[model samples]
Every structure is written in structure tokens, then in C-alpha cells.
Target: MASKYRRGFDITRDSLRVFTREPSLLLLPALSFLAVGSAFAVLAAILFQQGLVESVVTNDLYKYGALFCAIAISSSVATFFNAAVVHCAAQLFEGNSTSVRDGLAAAWRARRQIAVWAVVAATLGTVLYILDEKFGVVGSLTRAVFNLAWALLTYFIVPVIVLDQRRKLRDQLRRSGSLFRETWGESVSATLGVSFIFLLVALPGVALGVAGYFILDGVLAVGALVGGGGIVVTAIVGSQTASAIVRTALYRYATTGEQVGPFDGRDPDTVFPEN
Candidate 1:
């Protein structure tokens, strides 16, 4: 277990090196957040204008349907941006320079697949939300386990969607599942390593917030809170960027049997040793 953690941490470090070289990759995810938030805002505005907010809130069916629509919109926007990230990252690994515009263009090309996958994602998410709301703790536990499985199973979905010509969602998911089975260790470890490291990194921000509330005064406290919030947000974005890069690297290796860029010196065997 310790060895696995170390390998995962090493992969995260390598991903960070890739990130340092082209920090603009961060812009993609930042844009994703903005895009998703804007999508939800627009959705809310539409609901309000239609005077459906009350019905959505008061009726379970309407509520779930509205939730599904909202989730679908956010999912589509996020998937589009994630496709951009995967496209840009793949280009970087291929020894080619890529820009945000180029990445967005690539995602735009795959917009149909993104739309289909978004509906699938939104459906699953809505079901989980309903289960949690209906059954409490048991539902929450089931949702968590199912969510993790779904995440691992679809780990390579964005890369596949962005790079492959497959139109059907099943075909893309099958490819992703195949790649996950081939490199499950590295994939899981990379996720754990990144999550652990970022959790630790975000702790100081949490501490700052606490200190501001208890030890600091007035404007200083507000400043500390704002600074702390900024740090936390940055950490969240950094973690997302690092994870996407590592995923792209893993996908490239699984598909091409070659690791490039920051992955040049890493031994493939060690990274994905025979089980």
C-alpha cells in the first residue's frame, strides 16, 4: 500500500512538472468552472422567467426533472471543457504546442458526443441524488460506492471522446473500461495521491480561516478569510488540472504504449506492472 502511494505521489509530481511548463492548461478548468456556473445561472433565470421555480420546488417529480435538466446543462458544459483539457494535454504529450483556442476547437468538434455523455451523466447523477434524498444514510453510502465505480469505469471517457471517432456512448465507455482495466493501479493511485496531497495543501487555508474567526480582528479577519478562500479555490483548481494531466498521460500510454513529455523518463513497467 505504501509503495502504491509513493508511485502515485511520484506520478502527481511528474504531472505537476508538466503543468509548470504550460500553466495555461489551468485556464481550461477555470473556464470550465465559469462556464458551468454560467450555465446554471442561465438555467435558473429561465426557470424563474417561466415561473416554474415554485412547481419545481413543491413537486417531487418536477423537482427531480428540473434537477436533471440542471445537471445535464452543467455536465455538458463541464464535459466540453474537460474534452478541451484532454485534447490540449494530449497535444502537449505528443510534442506539439497547443493553445486554449485549439483545445476548444477540438472539443467543439466532439460536441455531439459531449451532449450524449452529458445526458447519461446527468441521469446517473439525478438518480443518485434521488436515492440520497429518499433513503438517507444507506442511500448516501450506496451513492458513494456507485459514484466511485462509475468514476473509475469512465476514467478515460473524456480522452476517448476527444480523441476517438466513436459516436456511440457505449463504444466510448467500453474503450474507457478497457483502458481502466489495463491501468487500474496507476489510475487509482494517481487519484488517491492527488486527492491526498491537495487535501494537505488546502489545510493551511482552512487554518487561516479558523484563525481569522478566532484570533484576528474585523478587517484583518475578513482579509484572512478572503485570502484563505482564494488559497482553497486555487488548490481545488490545481488538483483538477493535475488529475486531468495524469489521466491524459495514462490514456496516452495505454493507447500508444509510449509516454511522452514529463513521462519520458518514467518506466512503464513500474507504473503498470503485471498484476
Candidate 2:
């Protein structure tokens, strides 16, 4: 029997479905740990920069704007890695009992596509940031328009990354854009739904930090750090998971019912060796 929820969303691969089927249950703890580790690294690096981060935050708003370019590049890399983890979890969900190393290996196997796509995404983001920062004309509106556009148009990326072994990254992007046109409404809604839920969680954490600053300075500060970090990482991971989920749906939809594209003779599974 096909599970009713099966039609709702899938993790990018069958394996990811196992993990993200209960996203908050399995994802939050690991995401928090990873976020904590990454945050400490970032904080330490900033602190060692001779107060560069703090100074920029306080004094130069314009230069601080440039940080988005850096963030955009970093986010591209982070997205690629996020796919890796989601796939690993999906494999386990599929009862494969796969290891995380396999996930990393799968990513390395597709490094060329990964690198090229990341560069593309990062460049687009950096360009947007530059235009916004430098001109301030048609900046926020333009960026927001593109943001909403890209949000809907790029659903095929993950499926292309995992399934279409023959298609290059650029080709897959084109193919997916056209393919998902039929379900464009769901695509937009899902992305916006996740974004709204994220803001709901995040805004409260920020408010708590501000309110607690006076009463319980140290504890609240720590709370803010942990909560803020968790929210950020969860949002990041949630996005990849959602992508994986939708990609899985599309893959199954294509294979079983639709004659949308030729079978690339791929299993759509990430294989790894025993560790």
C-alpha cells in the first residue's frame, strides 16, 4: 500500500525520506551540534580578526553588506553538503543502513557538478549583493523578485544532482525548470511555508535574547547563542531536506507514471562501502 504521506513529499532520495519523515525529531539535534561546532569556529575566527567583525558591525554598514557575498558563496557550499547528509539519512530510511561516509563519498563522486552548480549559485548571489550594495537602485525589489523567482524555478536541482547521471548541471537546471512548471504552485507554497515557519521560530528567539539581556545577562546570552544557532542551522538543514523531499517525489513521479524524460538507467540511490 502506498502511504498517503508518500504523495505529500519525499526526501530527495529514498534514503533521506527515512530521516526527514520526522524532520524535527532526527534533524534538530544533529543540526544543533553541527551548528554549534561551526558557530564556534566562526566566532573564534571573527574574534581573532582584531575586532574586524565587531568594528564592521558597529561602524561600516556598507562593508558589512559585502559579507552577504561571502555568505552566499558559503551557503552554496553548505547546500551541497546538506544534500549529502539528507541523502545519507534517506538511505537509512530506505533500510539500507548506510553510513555518513557513504554520503560524503557520494558527494565527492559528483564533485564536478557540485562545484559547478555551487559556483553558479554563489555568483548569482554575489552579483545580487553587489548590485544591491553598490547602486541601491532597484536593489531590494529586484533581489526580492529574483529571490521569489529562483525559489520556484529551481526545484529540479537536487533530482538532477542525484538521478540524471547523463545530464550536466546546466542541462538539468533547464530541464527541471520546464518540468516543474505544471506544479509550480506547490513548489512556491512549500518554499514559502518553510520560510514562514523559520521566521516564526527565529523571531521569538531574538525577542527572548533582547528581553533577557537585562535580567539574566550571561544565561540569556548563552540561550540566545544556542537558540539562534539552532534556528539558523535548522533552517539551513530544513531547506535541503525539503528539497530532497520534493526531488524524491518528482523522481518517483517521473519513473512510475510520467513519460517526462528518458530513463537514465540510474537507481537514484547513493551507494557506500562498509566502514
Against the reference, the lDDT scores of all candidates come to 0.84, 0.54
RMSD of each: 3.1, 9.0
Give the TM-score (vs. native) of candidate 1. Answer: 0.86
Count of clashing residue pairs in every prediction: 0, 9
| lDDT, candidate 1, 183-258, per-residue tens | 8876776677788878877899999999898999999999999988878877877787778888888888888888
Could you tell me how far off, in angstroms, the CA of residue 157 lies in candidate 2 after the best superposition? Answer: 1.0
Model 2 CA deviation exceeding 4 Å by range: 1-17, 20-69, 89-97, 224-243, 258-275
Error of 2 at 59 (Å): 13
Off by over 4 Å in 1: 1-9, 19-21, 44-58, 136-138, 210-217, 268-275
TM-score of every prediction relative to native: 0.86, 0.64
- lDDT per residue (tens digit) for residues 1-275 in model 2: 13312222222233233554344434433543465467557755865676666565665453444454455445555555655654564454355765556666765677777767766776678677667767687887788889778756667665557556434766877766775775455455434444455455567656655655655667667787677666666655555555455455445444453311111232222111111
